[model samples]
Target chain A: MRTPLGKVRNHGAGAAGTGHFIAQRSTAIALAVLAPWFVVNSALSLKGGNYLGAIDFLTQPLNAVGVILLVLIAFYHMWLGMQEVILDYIHRPFTKVLLLLLNTFGLIAFGAGAVFAVLMVNFGA
Target chain B: MAGATRPQRPLSPHVQVWRWHVTMLTSILHRVTGVALYGAALGLALWLMAAAAGAEVFGPTHEFLLSPIGQVALYLIVAAVAYHLANGIRHLVFDSGAGLQPADASTSAWFAIFFAIAAPIGLWALVTFGG
Candidate 1:
C-alpha cells in the first residue's frame, strides 16, 4: 500500500513535520522574554488589586503593545501545544477533528478579542 | 480490520507502567501547566475585555479577581507559569542536543520544580510585605 515516494518523504498528513517544531520553539523563545517581563511588571504595577492602575498600565503605548504581543504569541503557542495533546490522546477521528478546529478558532477569537480590547483602551474607544 | 482479525499492536509503556522519575514528572507537568496556562490566557482576554468595557464592568471583575477564590486561582496560575517557564527552558536546552544526560536532565528538572514552588511564594511575600 505504500507509495515509494510517500515513504521516502515521510512528512505525515500535514506534510510539514518540522513546521510545528520550529513554530513551537520560536514562540517558546519569545515567551521566555515576554512572559517574565509581563509577570514582573504586572506584579509591580498591579499591586493592591489596583483596578485603575491596571487600566493606566495598559493605556501606555509600550505596555499596550507588549500586552497585545503577549496575547497573540501566547495564544498561538497554546494552540500548537493543545493540538499536539489532542492528536496524541484523542483517537476518534470526529472528536479529534472537532477539537482541533475548536482549538484553532477559539484561540484566534480570544486573541483577537484581547488585541481589540487593548487597542480600545489605548485609543479611548 | 474491524474485528478479532485485526492485528495486535505493541503498545508503548504509559505512565502507569513506568517507574516514576523527576524527568517523567517534569515532562508531564510541562503539558499540565501548559493546559493551565491555556485557561489563564482566556482569563487574560476576559480581564482585558472587561477593562475596555469601563469601570462598571471591570469593577466587579476586578473585585472577583481579588476575592479569596480569585486569589487562589491567580496563585495557581502563577505557579503554573513558573513551572512551565522553568521546565520549558529545560526542554529548549534539550532541543539543542545538550544536557540530555540523566544526571543533568534530572538536576534541571528538580531545579524547575523548586523554582515553581518558590517563585510564587516569593512573589506573594514581596507583594504582601515589601511595600
Candidate 2:
C-alpha cells in the first residue's frame, strides 16, 4: 500500500552504512599487520614478564607511536564491531540504547586512558 | 505505532536450525573470538595503565601475568588472537568477493582453526628453545 519512496526512506543506507563498512574493513587490514607485530614483540620483550623491559620497549619512539596507533585503531574498530553486535542481538529498546551509549563512552575512556598511559611512559611524565 | 498491527515476521535460520558446517563454526568463532579479544583489549589497557603507574604498582600485575593461571589466560588470549586474525583475513577475502564458494570457505575455515592451534605452541617453542 505504501509508495516505493515511502518503503525505502527509513530502511536503506541509514546514511552511514557504507562508511561503517569501509572503516571496519580498513581497520581490520591495519590490525592484520599491527597485531602480529605487537604479539611477536611482546613475546620477545616481556619474557619472564619483565616490567622494565616493557618500559624500555615502550620508551622507544617508533614503538611508542606504534602502540598508540594500535590502541586508537583497535579501540575504534572494537567500537564499530561491538555496535554491530549490539544492534544485531540486543533487541530490547532500553538495553540496546543503553549498551550502545556505554559502548561508545567506555571505549573512548579506555582508549584515551591507554594512549595517555603510553604517552606518560614515553615522555617520562 | 504500527507495531500492534504488524504481522509476525519469520526469523532467519539461527544456530539451532542450521546444519553443522565448518563455515558455520568459523562464522560463530569469529564473533566469539571477537568478544574474547574485546576482553583482551581491556587487559591491554590495564597493562599500559599499570606500566605507567611505575614498577611499584606494575609488580603485582607483571607477577600475575607470569603466574600459572595468568599463563593459561595468556595462552587462550593468544589462541583467540590467532584465530581471529586468520579468520578476519578470510572475511576480508570474502569482502573482496573472492573465496565465497562453499568449498573454499570451508578450506579457509579449517586453515584458520589449524593456525589458531599452531601459533601459540609455535610461540612457546620459540621462546623456550630459541633462546
Candidate 3:
C-alpha cells in the first residue's frame, strides 16, 4: 500500500484514525444524553413567549454550562461527520482538501462564537 | 490534472446502480441527517449570540422561533436528531462487533427508522397538547 509519497510521509492513518473514531463515538454518546435535555430546555425556555425569561433560564449556571457543552461538542462532532461526507463525495483532490479546510475553520469560528455568547450571557457582558 | 486522457477508474456501486435495502437506505439517511444537523448548528450559534446581545436582539430571535416557518423547521430538526441518534447508536453497536450479521443489521436499520420518526412525532404531539 506504500506509494513513494506515502513512504516519504512515514506515518499511516494510525493514532489519528483512532482518535477520530473515539471522538466521533464519544461525542455521539454525549449527545445522546445532552440532546434530549437541550430540546426540552429549549421548549420550556421559549414556549411562553417570555423572551426575558428565556434569557434568564439560559443564564442560570447549570443551563448555561449545559448549552455551552452541547454546542461545543455538537460542532466538533459535526466537523468530523462532515469531513467524512466530503471525503466520500468530493473525488477531486484539491477541491476536497479546500472544502475540508473550510469545514474545519467554519466549525472552529462558530463554536468559539457560541461559547463566547454563552459566557457573555452568563456574566452579563 | 489533465482530463481528456485520464484512465477509466472503477467506480463503486451508488444509488443509481445498487438495489435498495434497509441498511442502504439507513446509511444514506444517516449522512443526510448529519449534514442537516451541521446547518442546524449554525442557527443554534446565531440564536445564542442573539440572546446574549440582550432583549433588543432576543426579541426577533424569539419571534422567529414562534413563527410558523420556525415551528416547521424546529420539528424537522427534531426528527433529524432522532433519526441520527438512533442510527448512531446502531453504528456504535456495529463498532463493538455486534449486529454485523445481515439479519440483525437489517432489523436494527428498521428499528432506527421507526424510532426516528416515532420519537419526534410523539414529542411534537406531547408538546402541542400538553402544558
Query: What's the C-alpha lDDT at position B89 in model 1?
Result: 93
For candidate 2, the per-residue lDDT at B88 reads: 95
Off by over 4 Å in 1: A1-13, B1-17
Q: State which candidate, 1 or 3, has the greater TM-score.
A: 1
TM-score of chain B of 1: 0.87
* TM-score of structure candidate 3: 0.87
Per residue, candidate 2 scores C-alpha lDDT tens digits across B1-131 of 58899888887879688778999889889999998899899899999999999999899998999889999999999899899999999999999899999999899999999999999999888877786
Give the residue spans of candidate 3 off by over 4 A: A1-15, B1-17
User: What docking grade does candidate 3 earn?
Assistant: medium
- Give the per-residue lDDT digits (tens) of candidate 1, residues A1-125: 23467656875564466998999999999999999888878887797766688889998888998999999899989999999999999999899999999998999898999999999988886
Clashing pairs for predicted structure model 3, backbone only: none
Output the lDDT of residue B14, model 2: 90
Q: Which residue ranges in model 2 land beyond 4 Å of their true spot?
A: A1-13, B1-17
Of the pair 1 and 3, which is ahead by DockQ? 1
lDDT of 2 by residue, A32-100 (tens): 999888887878777875778989989988889989999999999999999999999999989998999
User: Best candidate per DockQ, number?
Assistant: 1
